[model samples]
Target: MNGTGRIQVARKVVGVGSVGTRAWVLLMDTLNGVEPLFLQAKEAQPSVLAEYCGRSQYANQGERVVTGQHLMQAQSDIFLGWTRARGDDGVDRDSYLRQLRDWKFSAPIEQMIPEGMTFYARMCGWTLARAHARSGDRVALAAYLGGSNAFDEAIADFAETYADQNERDYAAFQAAVDDGTAQATTEI
Candidate 1:
């Protein structure tokens, strides 16, 4: 929440993923049009990985998501919070809330130059390594990784297999849509 008296300047649904509903809200101080704040709220549900990894410790799914993000990210949004609201089914559902942006811009992944892509990939790898090191024994991980390309090759193979499986699943989904078994809305 804003410390000062900020009013809701605008609000809209964010057209992105199909996982759940997401909304963007803009707040502005009446006197300062240049310093508007934007926040995004997203509906949260039990993670699919829960089936194999066991249940989350947090009772609310929103809290679980926000907490996990806080743990994994080096820098987190200060406004991150969680709330529960009645869903369309008349049941309470959890939602994660946070600032949509904080002077940070995203690189257009599809249009990035090769050098930019390489930089982005390396940055992502470093960030992930930091997260892993924070959550696990750095020495043990280093030992496991070793000074070899074997692990890298194995990981690449796994990624290839995963991508192939994803493509096959997409094909099945397309077939279902064609046969009227499933209907997909692209407007989102």
Candidate 2:
């Protein structure tokens, strides 16, 4: 995995000022061990973004790995497929939240974080929505996040319910396992 490379395709449609610059830098650092293929939209100071993305340093052994994302989604899909084949487990909610925390400080401009913050909230909401759809538990996910709002209402509801049920399920399972009433192939 260390030798693997990541191709990052990002758009500056929202804006390329300090926020965009910071995002580019963080993406580069986060993927340090791997080869980086970067593609910046032409609308966002194309020349400057290209220069930064393609910069070569002596420390990198003169390897210029960054490239444009002309192919965009196709390239992204291929790279994702390759990563999946390499046994990289997809990011889960916990890991996603951690990444958000890291991005907050690493971002180029702190004030440009409102949108980014919303992204995390939306993710949480989506996860909770899915869980609710599956378990038919209206308040399960919402309780986890505390309150109901456009950002993470669904998750908060689902989490609240899930916690209640999960507690009961876990207690029963643990008692059964301890008493040898439940057969198991391994200990959790």
Per-candidate TM-score against the hidden true structure: 0.63, 0.24
Runs of candidate 1 exceeding 4 Å displacement: 1-18, 22-36, 87-89, 107-117, 156-188
lDDT of 1 by residue, 114-149 (tens): 999999988977877799677667799899899999
lDDT of each: 0.79, 0.40
Return the TM-score for candidate 2, rounded to 2 decimals: 0.24
**Window of ten residues with lowest summed lDDT in model 2:** 92-101
Q: Give all candidate RMSDs, comma-separated.
A: 5.2, 19.5
- lDDT for residue 163 in candidate 2, whole number 0-100: 95
Native-vs-model 2 lDDT?
A: 0.40
Please list the residue runs of candidate 2 whose C-alpha ends up more than 4 Å from where it truly belongs after superposition: 1-75, 79-154, 184-188
